[model samples]
Target: MKQWKPAASALLAFSLLLAGCSSEQDAVSKPPATQNKQEKPSQPANAAAGSETSKEIPDAVKKPLKIAAIVQLSIGTFSSQYAQGLKEQVNEFGGDVQIYNADNDLSKMASYVENAVSQKVDGILLDHGRADALAPSVKKAVEAGIPVVAFDSDLNIPGVTVIDQDDYSLAWNSLRTLAQDLNGKGEIVYVWVGGFTPMERRNVIYEAFKKRYPNIKEVARFGNASQNTALDTQSQMEALLQKYPNKGDIDAVFAPWDEFAKGAARAIKQAGRDEIKVYGIDLSDEDLQLIQEKNSPWTATAATDPADVAKLQVRFLYQKVAGEETPQIYSVQPHLVQKSALPEQKVSMNDIGKYVEGWGKSDAAISAWMETLSKEQKK
Candidate 1:
C-alpha cells in the first residue's frame, strides 16, 4: 500500500463524506437498472489499472489520494451520467472520490469547497457553477498545493484546468442543420432557459445564425430559466402557436437543450401542427427517441457526450497530478444527428446504457473505442 499526502482541508472532508454517504444511500435505494447506465464501462478498466498502478507508488507516497467532486445538480440524467463516468475513472485509477452537490445554490458550492479543503483531499473536481463564488476557496486549495480540475464549467481561475463542451460551435451546428433543413428562409421560434453556461453559449451561436442566414427570422424567444421545466416551455410554446396561428407564419422551432425541444414538440403535437420542425442540443436517450418516431417535430439535435467529457477531465486531472504537461483548456466537440440518418436504426436510452454497461465487461474494447474517438478528434 502506498501512503500519500492528503491535499484537502479538514472541513472539506466531513461535508464531502456526509454528502457522499447520502448520495450513496440514494444510489443504493434505486433499482440498479434505473441508475444511470453511462458509468458502468469505465469503472472496471480504470479500477483495474488504478489498482495495478498503486503498487508503482513508492512507500514515501503510500497514502491513497482522496478526491472531492462537486456537481451543479444531483438528479438530472445528464449530471448523473457525468458523475457515473467520473466515479468509474477515479475508481479505475485506484483513488476514492467523495461526491457533493450544490443543487444550483452558489452559497452551498462555496461551503462545499471550503469543506473539501478542510477535509484535506488530494484534489477536487468541480462541475458547472459560478466560478467567482468558488474563487476564494479554490485559491485556498491551490495555495495549499492541492490540484483542482473543473469540468462542464468555466472557471477563469489560475491553476485550475477546465474541460468542457464547445457550446458555441454545437449551437451553431445544430441551428445550421435546422436552417439547411428549412432551406435557409424561415421563421423560427427560439426557446431557451437562460443563465446556464450552455444557454449563454447558445446565445452567441444564435447571434452567429443571424449573421449566417439573413432570411431566417427569429419570430419569438422564450426563456424558461429552469433546465427541467418542460411544462413552462410547453406553455410558452402553446402561447406562441396561438399568437401565430398561420402555419406559414413559423417555419421551425429551435431550443437550446433537449428538454426545451421536447416542450416545443409537445406544444406542436397539441396544436396538431406537424409542419414545424424542431431542433435542440444534448442528444440524450429521450431526444433520440423523439427523432426516431416518424411524424415527430424533433428532426435533429446536437450530441454532447457527457461521458466523454467526464473521461477527458479524469484523464487530464491524472496527467496534472502526475506532473505531466496538459492543456489548460480542453473542449469536446458536439455531433449533429438527424432523423433521416437513423433510417432503420433505432435510438434509445438503452443504446446509451449498453455502451456504458459494456465498458465494465472489457477493457480492451473500451480502449479501442477511446483510441478511435481520439483519432476522430485529430481529424
Candidate 2:
C-alpha cells in the first residue's frame, strides 16, 4: 500500500467539511424495505455497478486515513475472511488499516484500544470483543473525537457506531428452515458456546425458538468449541451421537456457526445417521463443499459474504472520518443458502462474489459515497 500524507490545505478543507456535514450522510439513509430483515432477495446486488468512492474527492482523502482494527479471537477461517474484507475496503479508499489481533484476550483488546487512542489514529474498528471489558476505553476514544465502529460487539456506548451480522435474523432464517424441514415437531440438539456477543444474540433467538415452537424438543444442549473449535466440536458431536444412538431419537441439529454444523454432519455421517439434518449460520467455500456433498447431513445456512461485511465496516468508519452521516446500528443483512443452491462445480469463497452481487452494496451508506467517487473518476 502507498503511504499517504495530507497537505496543509487538504487538512484544513477536510476539517471544514467534517464540521458542516450532517450525521445523515454517514448513516444508512432509508434503507430498502428488505434491509435489516431476514428476507433474501432473489437477485443479489449488482457487482458490475462497482463500489463508488466518496464524492467531492477531498484532498484529505488522498492522505491515507490511518485506522487500527482490533479483533477478538482471530482463530477461525470466518475471522480471517472478515479481516480480509477490512483490509481490502481500507485499501480501496486509499486508507491504511493495521489489524491488531486480540487472540480472544480481553486485556490485550483493551490495551489495543488504548494504544490506538494514544497514537491518535484517524479511527478504530473494534471487532468482536466484549463491550463490558472495552467500553471504558471506547468511551475515551469517542470522547477524544476518534470515530469508532464496532462489529459483532454489543457495546452500548452512546457515541460509538455498531455493525453486526444481524445475528437474530441469521439464526431465525436458518433455524426456521430446519423447523420447516422437521414439520415443526422433532427432537433437536443445539450446539453452542456462550460469551461472544454474536453468539449471545443468536441465543436470544434460540430461546425465542423454544417459546415459539414448543413441540420441537431440545434433547441435548452442550458445546465448548473454544480453542480447537472444529476438532472439539467434532468430538462433541461424536459424544452426542453415542448418547443418542437411535437415529430416530434426534431429527435435526442446530449448530449456529458453520464449524459446529460441519462437525455435527461428520459425526452423523459416521454414525450412519444420514437422516439427521444440520442447519447453521455463516457459510464459506469449505462449508459449501460439505453442504453439496451427496448424502451429507449439512443442509442450509444463513450468511453474509464476510469480505462484503468487512468492506461495509471500513466504509462506515471512512464515512465517519470524512464528515459523513452514519447510523448507530447497522445490520449487514444475511441470505439463506440451502444444499440445492450450491453450485455443481467446486468453487472457493471468492467465486461467490459475482453471485452474491456485492452483497447488498447499495443499501450501505458507503454505496452513495462510492457513487460520487465513480463520477469523479469518470471526470
Candidate 2 wrong stretches, greater than 4 Å: 1-54, 350-363, 367-379
lDDT of each: 0.64, 0.73
Candidate 1 ranges with C-alpha deviation above 4 Å:
1-64, 348-379
- For model 2, state the Cα shift of residue 162 in Å: 0.5
State in Å the error of residue 44, model 1.
26
For model 1, residues 141-188, the per-residue Cα lDDT tens digits are 888877888875656565676655656556766887888888989899
TM-score of 2: 0.81
TM-score of each: 0.73, 0.81
Q: What is the lDDT of residue 52 in candidate 2?
A: 40
The prediction achieving the highest lDDT against the true structure is 2
Ten consecutive residues with minimal summed lDDT in candidate 2? 1-10
* RMSD vs true structure, all candidates: 14.3, 11.2
Task: Write out the backbone clash pairs for model 2.
Answer: 23-325, 25-325, 26-324, 26-325, 26-326, 27-325, 27-326, 52-370, 53-370
